[model samples]
Structures are given as structure tokens and as C-alpha cells.
Target: MIDNEMSIEELEQDFWGEPSFSSYVVTTCHKARQKPIKDLSYEEIRCLIGQKIGLRFVLSVAIDILQANPLIDVIYYEGDLLLAVLRLDLDDWKYNQDELKTFISILQENRSKIENFEEVSNELVNKYLQIRL
Candidate 1:
């Protein structure tokens, strides 16, 4: 039986359309905030991120890309920018490069629409740096 959990190599082929980059880099700035977000706990951050994910379709698209291809992995950052790195599966990369690119393109296009998105730590002194995720 074909394993549902495709390897990273397979995913890469499915997405990039070639063995190009090991991973796809997606960097985005949060939506404008009335007051810059200050230091927050991991839980708080997760909640905020979740909110963004729901509000923004890009998040869903990203999730779909990962779900369709398990070889792809995601990394999120809570600093000045919301960055997500997707490690493409070889198969996915090869088969769906346009789709993968489109997904990321949408994220980049709508990044400016984030109204409450902000960094966990602004200029203020945030004691919470280490978050267990």
C-alpha cells in the first residue's frame, strides 16, 4: 500500500516542480496595530497567531499545502515579522510548483491587511522570551 505520509523528497518533487531549494521561504509583516503588541506568553502568542491564521486565507493555504504534502514542514516566528518556512516535498515541488508559488504569493499580497497583528515583543522590556512550543 502507498503510504499516506509521503517523504520530504516526494513532496519537494510535487511542489517545486524541480529539485531546487530544499525549502521555500515565506516572510511577512503583521497587519497594522493600534498599539504595538508588547511582550506576551507563548500561549498568548499562539492565540494571536491562531487569530491571524483564521483571519488570513494565506494561513489556510499554507496549512493545506502542508497537509497535502507531509514532507513540507512549517516554522513560525513571533518576532518583528511573521515568518514561515516550508520544506517542500520533492514530488509536491515537481508536480505543483505553481500551486505552491500561488499559495505564498497570496500570503505576500495580503500581509498588509493584518489589523491587529504585531510582534510579541516590541520596544518594551519583555521578560518572556523562552516559550515551550
Candidate 2:
């Protein structure tokens, strides 16, 4: 089982070590990519996972963060992380079914945390569930 505490360095990386994108957010993701998962702030994780940069490595950490605080946000309002996560490609979950299952469980588990948050769209979450379930 890939627990939340695992090192992202353990995962295979698909990109070069340096920042390829010149944007500010991509720069932030490049920095976050170097840091240990435990060291990342919610925003950094959000950017990396939101952009699908090093997603396989960052996902478990991001989901663990979501499990802890489902409404975790960055520049956007609460639940921004979930919104980003919900936008991920389902193909990313192919070999990581266990992790995907855990992520879905986290969504199910955290429903109460998000269901009523004004900034989060419950309809989106439900739509994701309809596809994922």
C-alpha cells in the first residue's frame, strides 16, 4: 500500500529535473517537485498536481492532504485542491488502482467536509463520482 508518508522520490519521474515551463506557477511546481512530500505547502502541491506535473508522485501526498483537510486551497477559495484533483486524467490511475481507490475513498470519506462548502461545487464532485464509481 502506498501510504501518505511514502517518499515521492520513490516514484518514477517522467520529466527532466529542471523547470521546463517559464510561468510562475510552473516554477513553483518545479521547486515543489524537489522538496519531500511532507515539506510541501498546500499551494505547491496544488500547483504540481493541478498541472499534472509529477502527478504520480504527488498524488498520494495530495490525497493525504485532502483527507486531512478536504477544503485545502491555494490562490483560489476552499476546495480548490479537490477541484484540481477532480480534473486529472483517469488514465493516470491505470497502474495505481489501489491509490485511485484510496483517493475515491478519500472523496467519499471527505464528502461531509466539502458537501456544504460554498466555494466547492458539489455537482462537480458528484459528477466525478458518477464517472469514477
Candidate 3:
């Protein structure tokens, strides 16, 4: 059985081997995919979620992390994680209602903090709201 408690690398994932993508973000997702959930940093989580690699496993963790820090950042700046989530496929969120709502709440609660740093974030956040989810 795949162990939630172990990293993909530790479990010796058989479906696919390690990926050596040319892009930094792509590489981050592969490296982060091998690390334990608890061991993953906010930036790594953001990278994985942004790539939509394993939402079934990673989405809830992202929610919990966002609850602690709605403005969860990456190398670029704050709210980058939030933006990554916003960019997630609408279908990816269809069955994830509770998690999606919690994320919306995080946006509502931290709107000012996000807008203060990323000027375009407000527009993106507004667009996210219009989605049927």
C-alpha cells in the first residue's frame, strides 16, 4: 500500500521514475514529490499544487498550510501559493467543496495582506469567486 506517512521516494514509487525537467518549477515539483508531507516547505507545497500533480493527496495539506498562513509564499512573493491554487483546474476542485470553501475563507480573511504585495492578485481572487466550484 502507498503510505501517507512516507515520501514517494521512500515508498519506492513504481508507476514512474524521477523526472528531470528543464524548468525550475517543474524540477521543484519532482523533488517535492519525493519528500514527506510534513517535511515539505510552503514553497514546495505551492510548487506541487501549482503543477496539479497529486491533488488527491496534496490539496488538503495545502488547505491546512493556508489556514496557518493565507499569504503562503514562494521565491517570488507572498500569496503565490494562493495564486497557484486559484490556477488549479476547476474540475480538480469539483469534489473538494469543504477544502475549497476553507481556501475561499483564507482569501477573504487575508485579502488586504495579499493585495498589499501582489497588485494583480485582487483581480485573480475576484475571478476565482465567480467560478461555480
Task: List the candidates' TM-scores in order.
Answer: 0.23, 0.73, 0.76
> lDDT per residue, candidate 1, 42-74, as tens digits?
322233334342112123334344334322223
Give the range of the ten consecutive residues with the poorest summed lDDT in model 1. Answer: 124-133
Ranking by TM-score: 3, 2, 1
lDDT of 2 by residue, 44-111 (tens): 88888777766766777777777777777666787888888887778866655666777778778778
Better of 1 and 2 by TM-score: 2
Which digits, one per residue and each the tens of the lDDT, describe model 3 over residues 75-105?
A: 6777677778878866787657778888778
lDDT of each: 0.31, 0.72, 0.72
TM-score for candidate 1, residues paired by index: 0.23
Off by over 4 Å in 3: 1-3, 8-14, 131-133
